[model samples]
Target: MEKVINAALCFDGNETQKTEWLDAIFSDVDRHYGYSNSFEKAIETTAGLMPQAFLNRVFQGTEEQQNRRSFFIRHGGIRRSPLSKIDVTDLIAWCQQRNTPEIWGLVASGIMLWEKADANENGYFLTTSAVTFLEAAPDPEPVLHAYADRVTPSGWTGSRADTMQPRADAIAELSLHVRQDISDAARSTSNRLAMEIERERIRDRQRDEDREQRFE
Candidate 1:
């Protein structure tokens, strides 16, 4: 709201509207009020992070859940458009339209739940960890940056050119995660095999012990 009020001075609104709405900003401002340099940068930095924007649009009750479920039925995994994909046959790209690979990776890692009725028919329906992740996110980044910049200030800097380096780094990090996920899946399979072998050996030993005790 404070950002909106200040931005209006340079952007849009009548004299009366600006005069009245200027009060929407605090008469006195703080460091936090000037967190982002401008509105455009603020929107980009805080994508899917604003609870006020998200909560209002979120599905609430059974009827609304069912309403959204119908859309998921038509498409897959809340992905509204198939045209955005690199190729329509590229299932991963299609899925990435809404939920990133990290979200799907978490589900694949067994930290969350997933289901598919068919090839394109999917339900991501993961809640508990998702709720926790959402709650923990908003508390840190701004505060951490503020304190970290005591010597050299670099608060919310989406407006800066340095942001491009971070973006490239993020893509590189995500690519590494793909390999990590593959290794994790292979480890899970190997561990499952080891578990079954142990169980079979234990069963054999127990059976032999029981037979010996019967003879005694």
Candidate 2:
């Protein structure tokens, strides 16, 4: 998944300069997944559906935070047994086992700051670009559905869809998560701003009252 994200980065970036991301992805996948699974092929497989922006955000944290994210991504975003869900203690313990003793608070903050999952809290269902490396992806069969309308004054109206592909399902799940995250952030920010505005208004009223008392 990291390799796939890095390959997505490769698509976004200019080839002129050296980058750490491109470096790591190329080194690991070719050596492991064989030359058949080239980065280009990976990107092509995940073209329109990849949550490129959200996956990039996963790498935007501190070095230690990035390590935590790496583990989460590798596990396909499942917070397995004993953990129940993505809890702070579980992540810290996991990191400790790997000898990555980054501050527990920092790890906790990372989880809260970036975590988004289903309503059931079952999985952090973003950036599941699994088709790249996996030889046998869930339900490889492509289910296509198409609709066409008669052309009137408004030219032609038609659409194509891969109705049921594992990759498409992954992408749709990601879109829902991203949308909910954005909505929640916007609501939280707006609420905070409103509270601040009300606080300022109360302060202004108190200041006016105090001035009147002084004048009297």
Candidate 3:
């Protein structure tokens, strides 16, 4: 399953080939899992298993770092460029102006910090740890509030904080859902495999008994 997902990720095929590969994978998953809904859920589950650090390395790393990664090197060497060339300060400014939570969440998830700064400090950057934690958290509100409290100036509460908070919360909520779906699918697969093993064991036992009776 991991191999299939990795192949999809590493596939350097053109649009038609990419679509074909994806369709084939989706068909196989549907056949095996007997899912009524689209196979996109299964794909999302597979993506949930990916390490946060790996995501950072892929999307945020320097050119040399990207080149060193085996998967990228094998898959035609990092085709998409990093989203931004700007430093953390510039990124924060850009995000502030855009005021988009999705973009903020993307920055939180993808950006890697060269130097850690106090949340209180001017031009403070979001750390990879904070972003990953928020994404995986089942209840992201508390964490988001805590994060906001830490970064926001004392006695300051306004529209900016309100807007940013919900956006971050939304990102975390979406991540939590994906993780849950992945967990459920994994459990379902494990149970199916277990049942197959048990059936095989019973069949083996029954065959042995029949042979013994025949010999007797």
Candidate 4:
């Protein structure tokens, strides 16, 4: 069976309602391409794309897990912070329209749980109430603030003054460079996957032709 799986977001509802939503989502997905047995299986298939080290951090409940989850959200173009109020119904609608992979939803749900738990070191329970709130709330707006308005020291005055400005500039430059690099890498990976998919289609077509010729 193909390893990849897709899932839709679940919104606020009672146990029966939630189960019905999930069932509908799964049934729709299966109608297109039958592979996944349940939402958990779909999520696991999505998680399988990550490096083992990253998966380790996620499962270990370490601070690194938060960073990784944040990275996924950012890279996936989910601009709003998980800490902000999110409308679950809108999110589910968006995911269904886009056919978003289940993995992204899993990461997002994890981030919500993390934020709700107040970054508790021990980890938070994934209660049904929390999931309901996540799905039922309205989509959050971007939190905009002017950087210049924030309080800061006028200038460096100590012995470190000479190097501080240059160091800061270099760090800022490197941050931009790293971001560009990541974008390029993601694009390259996407292109490669597309090529592989096309090749598979060509092979399937060729196999069908061969079978038809043999019968002739």
TM-score of each: 0.20, 0.20, 0.21, 0.20
Model 4: residues with Cα > 4 Å off, grouped in runs: 1-83, 106-111, 115-123, 127-216
RMSD of 1: 21.2
Poorly placed runs, candidate 2 (over 4 Å) = 1-178
Q: Mind giving the per-residue lDDT tens digits that candidate 3 earns over 1-216?
A: 546665665545455664554445434433443222334433433334323322333333355443333222122112221222224444455455555454454444323322234455323334555555455444444434444333322343333343233323323333334566533533443344345445645666787789899999
Question: Candidate 3 versus the native: TM-score?
Answer: 0.21
lDDT of 1 by residue, 52-74 (tens): 22222212335544344223222
Cα lDDT, model 3, residue 105: 46
Pick the lDDT winner: 3
lDDT of 2 by residue, 56-136 (tens): 433555665555444433322222211122433444344444443233222222232222356654233222212121111
Residue 5 displacement (Å), model 3: 2.6
- Give the lowest summed-lDDT range of ten residues in model 3: 72-81
lDDT of model 1 at position 183: 31
Q: Answer with 1 or 3, whichever has the higher lDDT.
A: 3
lDDT of 2: 0.33
Query: In model 3, where do residues sit more than 4 Å from their true spots?
Result: 20-99, 102-128, 131-216
What clash count goes with each model?
0, 0, 0, 3
lDDT of each: 0.30, 0.33, 0.40, 0.34
Which pairs of residues collide in model 4? 87-137, 87-138, 88-135
CA RMSD per model (angstroms): 21.2, 20.2, 21.3, 22.5
